[model samples]
Structure formats: structure tokens, C-alpha cells
Target chain A: MIEVAGLKKSFGDVVALRTVSFKAEDARVTGLLGHNGAGKSTSLRILYGLIQPDTGFAKIDGVNVSQDRILAQSKLGVLPDGQGLYQRLTPREHMRYFGRLHGMTEDMIEQRSQELIGMLDMGSIADRRTGGFSQGERMKVCLARALVHNPKHIVLDEPTNGLDVMTTRKVREMIQELKTLGLCVLFSSHLMYEVSKLCDEIIIMAEGRVAAQGTPEQILATAEESSLEDAFVTLSERVAQI
Target chain B: MNILRTIVAKELLDGVRDRRSLFSAFLFPFLAPLFIYGLMTLVIQQNTETESITLPVINADAAPALVAHLKEAGFIIEAFEGDPEAEVAAKTVELVLSIPIDYQKTMAAFETTRVTIIHDGSRNDTSATVRQVRNLVRIYSSELNALRLVSRGVSPKLMRGLQTENGDIASDEQRAANFLSFVPIYVLMAAFVCGLGLAIDQTAGERERRSLEPLLINPVSRLSIVFGKCLAASIVAALGMLITLGMCLGAMLMLPIDELGIRFSLKAQQVVGLIMAILPIPLLASSLQLLLGLFAKSFKDAQSYVGFLVFIPVVPTLVMNFLPFATSFWMYFVPVFGQSIMMKEILGAEPVPLLAYPAAALPTLLAGLLVCWLTSRLLDQERVIQS
Candidate 1:
């Protein structure tokens, strides 16, 4: 389980996140929603220990993300935007490299890579350099990089942004699969339908603050609407009024 | 350790693959010497042209024998119609030889009659030609004195002066070879140039690509991470210098045998001394470059910042020319200054004092490490890395 309290972060005078707090509980998909400047990515980045919060902390299984980030991060996998790959590395080489970073031996990395390749259907391109891959292909390779070590949580920011419908389905299926394995998955996205379909719980952020947090049905009911689309419209309208 | 190996492997693979490093590390060193050397050779050949000395004169010597001998020694005999002063302004001749009116009369009494030779000092070759002509005139006049003494029945051997030729043993080839101060300035340059691409790519390239975050998230010490990258950069730079040295030695050895009379290539000991002197320059340069590149935002930013990198190697070379710093064994341990002095030593000059090499080099290496530590601190700062 994860817990966050009073997280604050800023870039110079412009605050990216202010007094924000949320958690991705064990075995649940927590969708973080926001408009362009909503701090979802910043919050997720902080939670993944890729950054520090100016005034608070997030913990996974009681281990502080800020203080023991590597330990906290070792318990989770992160696929940051741009699908960070070394470009020159083949899929197997890339997987082996990240595995080594987390302190896995060559044998262990090799063992884990085989399993991931089979599961992700990435066997065909395992030996090909990631530089030549399409956007969707690179994303799967990145996902494979994160999953090779099999962390208990996964923090993916806009993981399906430029994917085809089939690949998008493939990625959402992977997230569902992680959730089934009792992994705490925090999904940050800008699309309302993407959140409504995949998330058990959603947190909407606006102007460096947490605007709302609840399940899809509950957030819809709070907007006094039936469907997620109309509910998002109502919630945004209310946010504008504020 | 595994992280370092992995990172180093990645760096090497990337470095070798980069077209920029390939050019700077392997290609540039070869072409640099050819262009500079070829250009210098062309200039020297054009400047040192040989031609006969032209002597414009009004001979006042009563002995016509002296005049005949002088003309035979390759001096173009131009008999002036009037005063030497009038000949200069009209530009009738390039030089004027003004022999005293009673030259032979004074010579009979063993009193030397001086000749005033005039030529345009602004013309570079004129002075050399004038000096050559003066020597010929003296020698020819000396020959007449010997003949006059022989005719008068005085001992000819007594008038014959002692003759000696002072010559050094070093061949023209050896002198030319030794002329190159072996200024391992190239070594220092090799270090910086080789490290340039690696340093820029490791820090600024990561920032530009937006991939620094993922690496930063790894639960490793920031110092460890920086050390790993710095280690790779240092190695890359050192390798570049070695490649440069190889090309330089190759070029020296391949110099046409007939063109250069002596072995222009460095001796094994000289090569060792050279390598020893410049060995640390790359380490120091790469460490500093990495630190500087980290402050930049992009490859272009890193490259522009490197405009200042030129100062690192140049300042020492420039400084030493004015302030004569004695080379000590302790000095070779300092960065650029040590390397520069060591090169000055290997120029077939005196060997560097033993203790002074390390005394100079240790502090420089320490300073390099200190700068690298500062860069590590910058890596920890979010603001610095983000930009």
C-alpha cells in the first residue's frame, strides 16, 4: 500500500503541486487526472521518487519515497514519458541494462527478460535496436524495461499517448494484469474516457491543487450526473466557478 | 561496480557510434599535422631563396689585382660613374660599396682602409647579402697582401694567418629534428578534444533528451553515478590523446627520407617522457569539461560553453612564456602547467627536476577531483539538472 500527505513542489515561483495528497492502494488502479498544468505528472514523478517534494512525502509500504527512494522505487516500476530508452540498445540489451541498475545479475536479467518477452509478445524484436522501433514498439520495450524486475507497483505517465488502438488495448490489458498481480498501479492521464474505463479511483487536479478524488461512479455522482463524460463536464464547470 | 561497468559499456558504445567523436578522436589528429606542417614548409621554402650579391662600387684601390679577385668571388661588379651617395637615390643599383680613396696606399703601410657598404635594411635578404659581400672583399684583399709580401722576399709563411673552421657535430637532420621543442601541447590538446564530445553528450545530451530523470531515480549515490560517467569521459579523452600521439609519431616516421636528413621521430625515451608528461592532462580536462557541460542546457550550449574550454590549455602555455616557472618533479603533477613545462624539458633541453614533477601535478589532480565533486553536487540540485 502507498500513502502520501501534504505534498508540495514548485519550480521557481510557479508551483507545480501544492498541498497535494493521494495514494495508490495495494491491488488498485489509481487514475490521476488533470488539465495541462494540473500537476498530475509532477505528482506522479515525485511519487516515483524521480523528484523531491518541497514540503511533504509519499511512502510505499511505509518506506518514504523521498528518503528511501531507491528502496521505494525498487518496489515499483516507472515508465516516464518519452519512453526512456538508450536508443542504441536492443530490447534484450536494454532490459539487461535496467536490470543491472536495480542490482540484478546477468543470469537473473536473462531469466527475467525471457519471461517478459513471452508475456509482452516482444520476442520478434528482442534483438533489434530500439532506435528503429515505432512509437508503440518503443513503448512496449520501455514497459518491458520497467516490468523486467517485477516491482510491486507501476507508475506510468501517459503510457498510451501515441499508440494504436490495439496497442492501447494491449497496454491497458497490461495494467489490468499488473492490478491482478496485487500491484499498486498509479495511472496518470489527460483523457477522461481512458481514466473512466481503467481506473477504480480517480483524482482530478486543477491549478496546483487536488480538485476532487473519488471512484468513477462516486465522482460522477458528486457531479450529479450519470455518465463519466457529463460528470467530467460538470466537475470542470464547478472547478471554473471556483 | 556493476553500475559502473554497465554505464561505461553504454558510454563506450555510444561514443564509438557517434560520428562526432569518431572524427575528433580518430580523424582530426591525423589531418591536423599534415595541414600545419605542409603550410609551414611552403612558407620557409619561399623565404630562404639564394641569389648572388650585387655590389655597386667606385674602386679607389691602386692595386687592380684586389678588384679582379673580388669580382671572381660572385660579386656582381657594377662600376659607378660618380659618388656612392648619388647612386642610392637614383635607384641605379641595389647596393653601394664605398671604398676609401687611398685603399691600396693605406694597405701598403698595413693600415686597413674601411669601406662603407649601404643597402636597404627594410629588405630582409639585403643584410645577409651585404655581409657575404663584405667577407669576400676582405678575403680577396688578404690574398693580394700575401702576393705582395712574396714579391718583396719577406717570408710568405709569416703573412699566412692561422685558419680554423668551427663546426658542430649534429647533422642538419638532427638539428631540424631537435628544433621541434617536443612541446606536448598536442598531448594536452588531444586530451581536451577527445573528451569534448563525451563530456557534452553525457551531461547536456541527457538533459536535452529528457532522460536524466530516469537515471537520477535509480537508488544509487549521486557521486557514484557522476564518478561512473566521469570515469568514462576521462578514458575517452585519454584514448583520443593516445590516438593523436600515434598519428603524430606515424607522421614523423613517414617523413620523406631525402627531404628530412635526420630521424625526426621521437626516441623511445622521449616518447615515454612525452606520454608521462601529458598523461594527466586528459583526466583533468575531461573532469572539468563534464562539470562545465552539466551546467549547460543542450549540446549547443555545452559546445558554446566549451569556447571557454580553450582557456584551460591556453592559459598555461601563455602564462609560462612570460613567467619563467622552473620545472620541478613536483610540477609534473599539476595539470596543464606541469604538462607544458614537461614538454619544454623534452625539447632536448634539460630534464625536469625529480621532486618538482609531483609537487606540481598533485595539486592539479586534486583540483580536478574538486571540480568533479562540485559537478556532482550540481547533479543533485534539481534546478541545475532541470535546465
Candidate 2:
């Protein structure tokens, strides 16, 4: 499980996050929803220990991220905001690299690689270099490597931001599968439809603050809107008024 | 330790597969030797050219005796009737020797007559040949005076003066060592050039590709990651330095250095000494490259920064070449300068101080570590990751 409380961060004069809080429980999919420049990536970055929050705490399985990043990172599987891969490395090599970084033995890395390749249906391209991989193929490689260590908490930032329909569906299915495996899966996205479809809990952010947090039904009831998209618009407008 | 090894292995594999990185690593080792060979061959050719001069002579009939004397002196004489001035001015020949029309009459009367050597004063290539011809003429003039004095019953010894003897202390090996001084510089250059691409690619290229954030997310210490990359680059650079040294030795062996009146050969111990002197440079070079690469905003920016960094090795060489300073004990503490001076001394068969190796290498290795440490500190910054 991942828990963040009272997270505040700023870059120079611009505040990236302000008094934001959320909890992503195991066996559930939680989505941080926001528009562009709405601080979704910044909040996730702090949670992943990439940046320090000014005044807040992010815990991965009860280990404070800021106090002990290595321990916190060991429990976290992250497909970060920038999911770049080595062009010359094959998918299996990528898996081995990350798996080794996570302190796995060669045998364990091999076993995990095989399982991920099979699960992602990436067997055909497992040995090929990723230099000219299509967007879907690249995403799969990134996702496979992220899951190589099989951490209890998985965080993906905009996992399907620019993917085609088929690749996007593949990513959505992977998130659901992780949720069913009793893992705490947290993702951030600007797509309302994807959030409403995949998330069991939603945290709506506006202007670096959490505007609302609840289940889809509770969010709709609170915002007095029929669709989650209209509810997000209403909640953001309410924050703007404040 | 295992994490460091994994990072190193991954970086090495990535570097090996990059055509650009491999090209950068191996290109200088091959080209530097070929360049040294070409340069040494040109030097030897120029030296030999001066030994056998072809002199174009005008009015040869008026000075047959002098022509005979020159031919005996090993000057290849070619009789000519054209304008001596024009021939030399056009560089059709190196120089022209014009015997004046009154040469025989003046010689019979024992009067001094000028034999004009028409040549371009600004041309340095023919200067040695001109001096040889003038000396031969002076010898012939003095010989004629000696014979005249003997015939007149005047002792030729009366004209003798104090004789000056030349004392040249430089040995043939010492002279040859001067020609081989560039060998050390080339080997040092290999250290800087070979690992440059990989160093930049691993640091700044990672950032530009946006792979750094993902890589950093893995459960590894920043020091381990930076050290691993630095070690990987240093390994390539060290290999390059060794190949360049071997190639330089081979090229030196193939050159006809003995024909240039110099004895040039490398002792087994001296080659080992040269290797030891330059071995630390790769570590220094890659660490500096990695440090500068971290500050760059992109891969191309890092390349520009690294391009300027290559001049570090060359600055000391150029200073030693142009504004040479006396070798001091403290020079052994400087990195490239120390390696350069040591390599030259080894090639020249001079005994290096026992402490010089550690004195030179330890500081370089330490500085590399310091740079790697600073890079690790930089890695912790959010700006570096996001930039």
C-alpha cells in the first residue's frame, strides 16, 4: 500500500504541489486525475522519492520514502513519467538490468523475465533491440522491466498517454491484473474516461491541491454531476473559486 | 559490489553495441600510429634528401677544376646554360652555381674572384646544401694557397692559425629521443579520445533520452551508479591507450631511424615504464568527462563541453613544446605533465625516480574519485534528473 499525507512542493517560485493527500490500498486501483499543469506528475514524483516534499510524508508499505529511499524504492515498481529505454538493449536485457538493480540473482532475473515476456505477449520481440520498436512495443518493454522486481506497490504516470487504442487497452488490462493480484496500483492521468473505467478510487487535483477524493459514485454525488468528467470539471471550478 | 558490477556490465554492453562509441574508442589508436609513421617517414626523407644534393651549374667550362673538386666531394653536378637566377627563382632546382667568366684568369693571377651561388635566401630546405658547397670552395682556395707557398719556399705553416675543435656531447640515442617525444602525447590523447563518447552517452545522453529518471528509480546508490559508469568508460580508454602504445612501438620499429644517423630502439623495461606512466590517465579523463557531461542539458551540449575538455592533455604538451620549463621534482605531482615527462624520460633511457610512478598516478586516481563523488552528489539533485 502507498500513503501520502500533506505533500507540499515548490520549484523556485512556482508551487508544484500544495497540501495534497491520498491513499492507494492493496487490491485496489487508485488514479490521481488532473489537467495539464495540475501537479499530478509532481505528486507522484514525490511519492516515488524522485523529489522531496516540502512538508509531507510518503510511505511504501509503512516505510517512509524520504527517510529511507532505498528501502522505499525496493518496495515500489515505477513506470515513471519519462519511461525511456536503452535503444541497444533487448527486452530480456532490460529485465535483467532492472532485476539485478533490485538485487535479484541471475536465476531469479531470468525466471522473472520469462514470466513477464509471457504475460505481456512479448516473446516475439524479447530478443530484438528496442531501437525501432513501435509505441506499444516500447511501452510493453518499459512495463515489463518495471514489473521485473515485482514490488508490492506499482506506480505508473500517464501509462497510456499517447498509446493507440490496442496498446491502451493492453495497459488498462495490465493495471487490472495487478489490482487483482492484491497489489496497490496507483496511476496518474488526465484522461477522465480511463480514470472512471480503471480506478476504484479517484483523487481529483486542481492548482496543486486535492479538490476531491472518493469512489466514483461518491464523487458524482458530491459534485452533483451525472458523469465523472463533468464532476471533475465542477470540482476544478470549485477549487478555482476558492 | 554486485550492483556496481551490474551497472558496469550494462554500460559496457551498451557502449560496445553503440557504433559511435566503439568508433570513438578504436579510431584514435589506429590513426595516431599511422600519423606518427607518416610524420617520421617525412622527417627521415627530408634528412636523407640533404645528404645527396643535385647542384645545377652554369659556366662549368670556366671552372673545370672547381667542378672536378665538387664532383669528388660527392655533389651530383649537372651542366647548365640557362639563367641560374631564373632556375632557382622558379624552384626548378634547389640552387644554381654560376662560375664567373674571368675565373681562370683571376686564378692564374692569384686574384680573388667571386663564384656566385644564386639561391633563394628564404628557402630553408637548401640551406644545408649551400653551406656544404661554400665549405668545399674555401677548402680548395686554401689548398691552392698552400701549394703556392710551398713553391715559393715560404712555409705554408706560417699561414696556420689556431684550430678550433667541435665538442658535440649529444649521443645518437638522445637525438632520436627528440624525434620520438610525440609518442607520449599521442598515447595520452588516446586516453582522452577513446572514452569520450561513452562518457557523454552514459550521463548526458541518458538525461536527453529521459532514461535517467527511470534508471535512478531502481534501488541502487547514486555512488554505485556513477562509479560504475566511470569505471566502464575508463576501461575502454585504458584499452585504447594500450593499443596506441603498442602501435607506436611497432611504427617506431618499422621506421628506418638508423638511416637518419640515430639509434632508436625500445627496451622491454622502458615499454613497461611507459605503460605505467600513462595508465592512470584514462581514469582521470573519463571522470572529468562524466562530471562535465552531468552539467550539460543534452547530449549535444555534453559533446561541446567534452570537445573543449580534450585540450587538457594538449595544453601541457604545448607548454612543454613552446615554453619549455626546467624539469622540477614537483612536476611529478601534475597529471598529464607528469605522465608526459616520465614517458619521454623512459623512451630516452633516463632512470625515473622510484616514487615518480605513485606520485603521478595516485593524484590522478584520487582526482577521478573526487569527480565521481561530485557527480554522485549532482545525481541527487532534482534539477539534474528533470533537466
In order, candidate lDDTs are 0.74, 0.90
TM-score of 1: 0.79
Q: What is the fnat score of candidate 2?
A: 0.81
lDDT of 1 by residue, B1-387 (tens): 888888777777777777765676655566666655575465344344334555667763454665666667756566665665555655566678776778767877878767777666666535666667678777876776787788889876896578678687865444544444332556567777777887787888877766677777666667767777877888878887887777666655555433434435456887776676666666678778888788876679889986578566666666765675554455566568777766656644355665655665676678778877888888767766664
Residues A1-242, candidate 1: write the lDDT tens digits.
87788999988899787788887788999988878777888887788776789998999889998888778888878888766667766899878877888888889999999999998999899998877788778888888888878888788888888788989999999999999999989888889899988999998877777767899878877888888877776776676576
Fnat for the candidates in order: 0.46, 0.81
Clashing pairs in 2: none
After superposition, the stretches of candidate 1 with alpha carbons farther than 4 Å from their true spots are A233-242, B36-178, B249-267, B328-333
> How well does model 1 score by local distance difference test?
0.74
Q: Residue B240 of candidate 1: its Cα lDDT?
A: 74
Poorest 10 consecutive residues of model 1 chain B by lDDT?
B174-183
